[model samples]
Target: MDPELLTIVVMNVMNTTRLVLHYFMSCETENDSVVPALLAAMETNNSRLLLAFTEQLHAVDRRYWARETSTEWWDRIVMHVWDDEQWLQNFRMRKSTFLELCAELAPALRRKDTRMRAALTVEKRVAIAVWKLATPDCYRSVAKQFGVGKSTVGAVVMQVCRAINRLLLRRTVTLGNVQEIIDGFEAMGFPNCGGAIDGTHIPILAPDHLAREYINRKGYFSMVLQALVDHRGRFTDINAGRSGKVHDAHIFQNTGLYRKLHSGTFFPDQKIPMGDVEMPIVILGDPAYPLLPWLMKPYTGKLDSSKERFNNRLSRCRMTVERAFGRLKGRWRCLFGRLDLDEENIPMVIAACCILHNICEVKGEKFPQEWSAEVERLAADFEQPDTRAIRGAQCVAIRIREALKEHFDHDSQ
Candidate 1:
């Protein structure tokens, strides 16, 4: 046994002794007749009484002092995630990117110096956590790969995820200056287009109480990842954790991004002057999002040649979000399967993935061929119905689509 573990066991025994004495002292006042029987049992080293008391203490003590095995899975597999390019991509990031993340996250994840038993290194803990997000493997499978207990794997996953949420999410996924947004979209041939908006469902184990709430139109339980992606395939804003049952329009309304866009805070109050009217910068969306001055959704139902041309152009721009989501789930394969976590915890994991996606984009991380394969796989399993019924701001939607239609028609001529 490790010296530290032995010391912990001795300390636990001593604490148990004090607790037993306190129980005896309390029993003397409450039940005088029972005290003699308890004393007799203790004196005799009664197996039943001692077993009951020691069993409860042992459960906690064993967990606290659980020894790390000598399997060296850290060196064999975890470290390989950083050293090999193929393995690094399989782990959902590049080598330099993973090390940068470790540097950013290490301070909070590191164990205190005063701990008696040594804890896993910060890099090891983070690698374990990322491997969980990057693959569909469960805790037991992951634990076996890492030579750690399942519960330890679970704890490390959650802890590293929480750190990512607190330290990285807001900083990495952000809406930058309005000019940057405009420039990014304009470079793609859609003038005044700020970004693209869309929603995707991340599969998760259904919650016990509200299982029905998570069932989407496709009949699978999932959590929705409603996002705004820039022209560069980076998420500028994300609203995760909505029930899969919710429509994209409803999810959009619930986000702070919606409030800002609706209130004219997202973009400059200045509007581009057309022949008869002025229009604010707009975000391109499919028919699922409500149309507003600052938001534009394509026309529904039958369309004329001009309208079809406009939709095509708009879709080309809107494909930014689709490709961004594709890369996101491709890089983080855990989103491909039903995440084995509590319902409340599913969002944190998704949010952390999004944050990492943006970091990879910033770092110029290329998606491997495997990422493209995952994208194709996901496209087949995830199907969404067109919810294009005119819900709100129909007049604005029509006028904007008409303007863009005329612009494209003239450009072609």
Candidate 2:
């Protein structure tokens, strides 16, 4: 044989012999007495012995593969367990609400013409969508548990999400009931307060392009979800998908709410009577937002006793938005972790979640126990002021805050 071929034969025999020896040594009854002869044979470079051993080892370690089992259990779980309240706790919604949601989404999510094999039903698809939001599992793990492919899970989630956004978002997330909002605020000791405004960062995977633009001051890639929440912890309006690096003020200015408020068409022009002073009915926010005639923020710098009282009242009321956010994120744990999706799709998903949150609130569903910690964490991540307000806006904001301070002080006396 050629010298190269001979060397190869010797190496193969040695490897085979090592494997057999190791396997035998692993057996509790096997003895170590055959080691001396095996070592001597390997030192002699026995090509013949190696050639014989190679054929024996080939069949010994033959690989076998099994096909993946179909995920028929997903249907069983949805139709069966999803209807049982005791077992339905896993789905994060009451059985009645789940069925109602399914019925509402059935028309939009119905698929009679699809060619995909073993296509998921609208009910299952909606369940999968809500399941993704309610749990921290990745697509693969969720798919495996649901007995579907990962791609299918992702597709179902997006399909149901878009359907929810299209069918329920506008109808459910409207600020049309301004009187209710005003009343709700008044009940919270903030008379004339229309809504509590605030911005939160929803963590996302940085885009391949404009990655830096998505990074906020906190050193994470996120998208800003600026919301106007009612006193009942429901989101009345939301403007999401802004670059995280932008300031809360900039994000607010870009929203339709800002445009409408600036144009003097969004809210009524009538002034709210506070003692002798007349102040505009406005939304409340932190100092990170601009202090418009229709928006209020707490005192930024030095404070005397009255200013301190004003800040405390504003903070106490402003915390409504924080609590709303906490409940939102707590109920939907998907928001707790970074979303591994394209940036464009994120806002729709968020909107869908907000819509569902409102539905739950209307239906009187409580936040899950698992979500309390996340809600508390989200409540703590308040936005700091990003820019110095223009001098005129600053002066106007100060006067409004001072007026409110007097109102609160007078009420205490």
Q: Which candidate's lDDT is highest?
A: 1
TM-score of candidate 2 relative to the true fold: 0.78
- Candidate 1 residue pairs in clash (backbone atoms < 3 Å): none
Distance from true location, Cα of 358 in model 1, Å: 0.5
- Predicted candidate 1 versus true structure: per-residue lDDT over 74-163, tens digit per residue: 776556543557655666667777888999998789986555656788887888898898887889888887778889999999999999
Residue-level lDDT of model 2, residues 309-352, one tens digit each, is 77777777789888887778877878868888788899988888
User: Scored by Cα lDDT, where does model 1 land?
Assistant: 0.81
Error of 2 at 269 (Å): 3.9
